[model samples]
Target: CDYELIKLRSVSLEALGENEPGASISRCNTLRCYPAKVPELIQNCCDYLEKNALQTVGLFRVGVSKKRLKELKDQVNLNRSLTFDVSTNAHDIAGLIKEFLRELPEPLLTRDLCSPFLNIPSS
Candidate 1:
C-alpha cells in the first residue's frame, strides 16, 4: 500500500449524532482513525439484519476539520464532511439510501447495501 489505510471497526454512527461534524470522530467500537480505508471496514463490521432490529446504521464525522481548503484547492476527494462511502453519520447513509430506498416498497429492509466496492487489506 502506498499509504497507510486504517480501519476503525464497529463504530456506531447512529447512536452518535452529528456532534463532531468533521473533526476527529469518536465511535463506540473502534479507536483513532488511522490511514486505513475506514468505509469498507465499517460495512463489514455490521452484523446480519435481524427482525425488528435496527440493522440500518450509518457513520459520519461529528465535526469537520478546520482544513477545508485542501479539498477544494487540491481537488481531492478526501474531506471532513464525508470522504468515503462509509459516512461519519449513519443518518447520512440512511438518507442516501432512503432517497432511493426510503420509499421503496420492496425488501429494502433486509438489503445490506454496502457503500462501494473497494480493495481494502484483508487483515
Candidate 2:
C-alpha cells in the first residue's frame, strides 16, 4: 500500500497580555486514512460539480477561499464548524466516487490494497 499520514495539530495560546506565565491551548487532530488516489479523483469530480452542482452541493461542495475563511474565523460565529464542514465535504465527495468505482450492480476492483494512508508497522 502506498500510504501517507498527514498529522495536523493546532495550538492556541491565550494572550499573555499582562503578568502571566506562558501556556498553550491546543487541540490535537487526527483524520482517518484514505487511499492516495483521492486528490486526482477529487479534482476531476470537482470539475463536474462546479459546472453543474455548485448550488446544490453547498459551501462544502466547491470550497471556500482560504483568505475569506480565515477572515471569517477571526470575525464571525460558527467559524470552526464552517472550516471543518468544508473539509468534510471534500472528503465525502471523494469517498462516494471511490465507492462507486468499487461496486454497484456490478463490482470493479480499483486496486488490491489496504487504505493507502494507513499507518502500518515496518520490519
Candidate 3:
C-alpha cells in the first residue's frame, strides 16, 4: 500500500509538472511575455474575476463542486484560449485560481520571506 501510494504521488507530480498551473513559472510555455511576470493562467483568472466576481458575496470563501472544478482545471491546463463561458460560476474560476497557486512547485512566498511576512503586524 505504501509503495502504491508513493507511485501514485510520483505520477501525479510528474503530471503536475507537465501541466500549466503546477509547472515552474520560468519554464512554463503558456502565454508568457518577454517582460511581464504573471502566468497566463493567473492573469486570465484575475481578469475574469475582476470583470464578473467583484460583487460576489463569498467570493473566495465559497466551495464549488469538485467535478466542475476539475473540468475547469483541465481546460486551463490545455493552455488554449478560455473556453468556459462568462456566465460560468465565479466560484469555479476562483477555485481554479486557488488551486493554481497551491500547486506551484515553490510557495509563492519563499522560506526566507516567510519569516519577515509573519513578523509584520496586522494593520
Error of 1 at 32 (Å): 31
Score candidate 2 by TM-score against the native: 0.20
Question: Residue 93 deviation, candidate 3, in Å?
Answer: 0.5
lDDT measured at residue 65 in model 1 versus the true structure, 0 to 100: 38
Which residue pairs collide, candidate 2?
3-116
Q: Identify the candidate with maximal lDDT.
A: 3
The better-scoring model by TM-score among 1 and 3 is 3
Q: 75-110 in candidate 1: lDDT tens per residue?
A: 222321234343233443333323322222333233
For each candidate, give its TM-score against the true structure: 0.18, 0.20, 0.68
Better of 1 and 3 by lDDT: 3
Tens digits of per-residue lDDT for model 2, 30-53: 221123322333344565556555
- Per-residue accuracy of model 3 over 10-120 as CA lDDT, tens digit each: 222333345445544434443442234555556777888898889999988899888887777556545443565755888988887776666554566879799999999
TM-score of candidate 3 versus the correct structure, residues matched by position = 0.68
- Cα error of candidate 3 at position 109, Å: 1.0
Off by over 4 Å in 3: 1-27, 31-34, 121-123
Better of 1 and 2 by TM-score: 2
lDDT of each: 0.30, 0.33, 0.60
Please give the lDDT score at residue 49 for candidate 3.
Answer: 89
Query: TM-score: which candidate is best?
Result: 3
